[model samples]
Target chain A: MYNDIIIENFSDPQHVGDLESADIELEVGNSVCGDRIRVQILLDDNKISNALFRAWGCATSVATANIFCDSLLNQSLDSVCQRDVEYKQQMLGELSPSQHHCMDILNELHQLLSEQRVAEDVANG
Target chain B: MDRQQLAGYFDYNATTPVSPAVAEAMTATLGQFANASSNHAEAIRNRNAMQQARVSVAEMLGTSADKVFFTSGGSEANNWAIKGRLFNHLNKPGHIITTAIEHPSVLETVRYFEKQFGFKVSYLKPQSNGAISISDFMAALQEDTQLVSMMYANNETGVIQPISEVAKITSARGIKLHVDGVQLVGKRAIDVEACDIDYLSFSAHKFYGPKGVGGLYIKENNSLSPLIHGGGQELGLRSGTENLLAISGLAKAAEEAKCAIAQWDQHAQACKHLMVDLIQQADISVEFNGDTTYANALSNTLNMAIKGVRGEALAVLMDKKHGFIISIGSACSNNKQKTLSAVLLAMGLDEERIQSSIRVSFGQYTTTADIENFVTALNQCVKQLSAMSFAS
Candidate 1:
């Protein structure tokens, strides 16, 4: 009951691994069932230079991790931090009703990424 | 190309497809809409289906036809058996003994009485092998215990409990015993009279019969308060117009299952061994969960944990990309406000085993080729998942 994007990404995920010498590493895990995603990104001049992810959960959750990391490449911290509902809608990408629970995992990942601003602010300060 | 398009069906414990004979029986009664409750000739003809169902179910359980009472399905039967007897003690709340691994129908029903009606419930836990200890049951018994509710076999792990041993104790103490026999009815022959079961519930859909029709076996002399208040039907216990078509299907299915129990057991056991051999030959490390031996559990079910693989993801990949159908646990595994399985949890399994666990259950329709395809797909899926998994 998954969409084409999920099937493709889950089968051959491009950004599924750990990034070496990364500037930001954050994780989001479901408290109940332990579906988790960890994203590591490298920054150049406060802009994302490379992004990769490691995920453990359902296929959609893993695919969404890769999809989320893919969207952050070559992006600035402010732009990533200022993500809105549109970003979530784009990442969800037509999941079925049974697979829709991963939307909450996406939101949690997005929230954790946004909260990286606090760490960035401290570094800048 | 959507490669995963229902290639193999291994989740028989969830529900069985209607057998050809059952389907034909149901189809024959589709247009005959005479209510079994009526007193006319057509109605009497329709009532024969239910009568036939009662006889077959009685033969399966080794009881008389008069002891079987039809209901909508196992859930209603469970509700009636538990609440019907306990409802009689509305003025006086007593004790109940059940297992922590019971189906939700029994667990939640006991929990509701504990919460709303002030009944004291002792939820006995299962040991590591997924079977409840006989000593634990004995310890849980209280002087004022009015009833004991337990399942004949677990739906997820297929762990069979010591019902006969418990029945002997309960019989001597005069404590009512209600066994949820939904999963065990078709797989094993049950003699409710020999075991002295006070009440038992069963379902049709679990054994190639049409869904939405099941029954409860009440001992000949036992009395239970009516769960439904309507015209007298099911001997004034469960009051509703009989589902004639589903009843016919149930009777036919039960008849076939009764005759084929030994053959099905051997077939399912062979398939289970084939799967185990395939898993053993694979390069990956794995651990089989639960007590899977036929002496302790049903041979048709196998719960296992593949190292570092998430079961839900594995199930999704297997179902969506690999054309295999399995489950992380039972259909209601995440129910009862618990995301993980209460059965495994009650058995004291650690979180990792529970997280990585997937259940593959087969039945009369399964074959060795299906098992081979499933294992090959499972190996590929595990490789794909492990390569991408953060923890693995």
Candidate 2:
């Protein structure tokens, strides 16, 4: 049972393609349900510019990947990394009990993105 | 919205739409006020309903009416077949031989017997084509084996088993054979006596009948202990008052199925071939999951793994956007999503292929136009989902 937002995004996902010019390519999956989400982001001056995704799983998870990538466009990398994990969990909007696992996929995608930034910060220092 | 509003529907194995005749029969029986077990003159209507229903069910099963016992549905019929046979022999050491790809009702029942009653079980793994090899079953046969439980056709892949061969062996050796014929009934002809099946299970809903009414056929000499001890209904094999309304519905369905079986088989075969032809003509890359040859499988079911797309996502796009309804695996096994199908997994399918596999089963209601429209919708959905998947 998906909400309107899920049905809308799942029907026609905009950011569902590979970005060849990406600065960071991150992939996360839920081994339980076999949901895989790969995100490719292009960074400009430590800010997100272009974001695209490739996903395989339920409709909710596929839509979540698109929605997550949409939220990252033109935002400073530091701000997203600083965003609370709790806030990131609900950023995908309301999910039913069955669709709740997509939140974990989103969080994992965010965590992978943050881990990449943390590594860059350490290397620069 | 109902299925009539959907763009396409191919999930007949899940449950068929109740036929109009079955509904009318059930409606007519609702006023049978007396209990089926009661012997008063006022009870004759209900009692006659149950008796006539039993006759029809037995005729459908190719058995005498005396051997038919009514239960709630396939699961209960299966439970009664397994536990009814093994419940009394728990203390004794015995062996059970069943396929790894059986419905959960039979699979879990045998597993429980092995763990709770110390009975040894041999789970016969399916061949790569999702078929149980006769040699493997022969190896599992033993002197101490008590019962062999297997399905007549797989619920997911629809691969027909070698029931006659196994029946010959088991009957000669005095071993009881319980066939879960839930999917095979009405779709194919069954002869329990000729096939030497000791216990056979079937459900009404599987054959365009009402739900909650199923029957089991026990051989004349083979007796199973009662699962429910109450007023001795169902020849004292299963207890409690019969659902007279549902029984009348099942009888009407059974009578209709006797004449419609061959016709259904023919129509379903045409639809199945049309689906395959459209997929090939569209240049869709898919691996047929089960045996494609009609000799080894049912003509109605076609399980395929579409390359570069997940089955669940494809099903979702078809259901939501295109209003198509299909299924990935057995509809009853959706409670646990973490695991892939034990049926396909037992057939040595890779996890990725198993995850991408979707089952498209046809029925008497399916038409050539429905198949063409379904393939068109499926093609578009597959292309869209493929673009989003890494496999593309």
Candidate 3:
């Protein structure tokens, strides 16, 4: 069962689809459950200017992706990287044990974004 | 407004609201405080009520009263049948043949026997039409096979299996056959004598009766070891104190269903036709899951897949936004797992189809207006979810 907030977010996901000319794009999926999430981010002066996601999976994964992207907007990459699975779980209250993998998708996205940032810095240097 | 009051119920396969007749019967029997096993006068009255309930159930199944054994519910009855048959030959665990789409009661019980005990099981996968082939069943039969269990109708797809044909094969082979009739008992008439079913399991709640009450029909001369050991109730096959109140309700419900079978069938067929027609008119890219011909499926159930939109999300949107209630799959598997429906997958449906499929079922009380409203709401939900999923 999902909480009211999760349902609301899933039904009307705020930021969805790809952002063309974006700074970074990341795609991740769980083969076991077949949930896939693709996140595109735009950077402005080292801060996240925009973040959008496209998800094809269960309610939790889709809702969590939207909520994660919504939280990333206007925040610096350091703060986005600091936000862990627990933070997202708190945002969407009381996910069942079976649905906890939704947060795993967020973690995977963060790892991808961090790796992309490091690769960009090395290239620029 | 409360969602319970406004929502259109399309999940009859999960459970039914107790009919007023069944409620009144249960209320009247609730005051009977005596134990049914005692020899006192009050106990005699309680015993009489149990026997009457048994007779009503047997009548519905077209079997004799003595052949029926009451259990907690369909799950318990299924467990009793599978475990009891295996335990009958305690030292020798032979082979079991069943379908992959059976309810967890049968699937899990067989799994336990295979893992904990030494029973070998052959799970027959359904064809794309959602029916198991009789030839495949015949081929799976082995010399050491002792029992075969298959459902009369699937809970998710409502696809009816050819149990009568399998029955003839098992009977001729001298192997015991058990039918999980939980989904079929009230939707259609079952003549145990005609079908030659050795054991059958049924639950009352699926037919407007009270929950926690069901019965198992055992053919004459067949014996099963007791699953619950005590009190010697249910002819010692299932031992526990009788649930007099629920049994009375079950009997009343069974009687009502028997009397109204033809009318109910017609109403359900009409509702299904109307819903399908309305869905077609909306021009949604939809694929009806399972046997859409109604020749092999129940009249009341319709499973469909809307391209691109997620089934679970659509179910939530329909319930939360539109006051419509339907199911993404079997109620038993809804909240427990995140995987696509195993029933659809076993029918050779791809992942997208499985994820987008929703099951809708109706009952005697469902009206034409209810079907119209459900289709309208479904059309809107599909359009909205499709936009959100496919938008750039």
RMSD of model 2, in Å?
2.6
The best candidate in terms of DockQ: 2
Candidate 3 Cα lDDT to native? 0.85
DockQ of each: 0.42, 0.53, 0.32
Q: Comparing candidate 2 with candidate 3, which one achieves the higher DockQ?
A: 2
Write the residue-wise lDDT of candidate 3 on B1-392 in tens digits: 23355347889999988988999999998889899999999999999989999899989999889999988899999998988888876588889999999999999999999999888999999999899999899899999998999999999888999999999999998899999999999888789999999999999999999999998898953568878998778776677788898899999999998898778878888989998899999887889888966678999999998888778878988887777788994211223355668788899998778888999999888878888888888888887776555342
TM, chain A, every candidate: 0.89, 0.92, 0.91
Candidate 2 second chain TM: 0.96
Which stretches of candidate 2 lie above 4 Å from their native place? A31-34, A43-47, A94-101, A118-125, B1-7, B329-337
Superior candidate under lDDT, 1 versus 2: 2
The digit string of per-residue lDDT tens for model 3 on A96-118 reads: 77777766777788888888878
Instruction: State the DockQ, from 0 to 1, for candidate 1.
Output: 0.42
> Worst 10-residue stretch by lDDT in candidate 2 chain B?
B329-338
Task: Write candidate 1's Cα lDDT for A3-93 as tens digits.
Answer: 8888778777898778778888888876655677888999998888888988877677788888888888888978877878876777768
Per-residue CA lDDT of candidate 2, range B1-392, in tens?
Answer: 25574337688888887888999998888888789788898588678878888899889889889999888899999999999999867778689899888888998888988887799999999999888999999988888999999899988898999999999999999998999999999998888999999999999999989889988888953478988899887766688988888889889999999989999988888888888999999999999988977778888999999887878788889888878888884211222366577888999998888888899887887778888888889889999998888877
Q: List the residue pairs that clash in candidate 1.
A: none
- CAPRI quality of model 2: medium
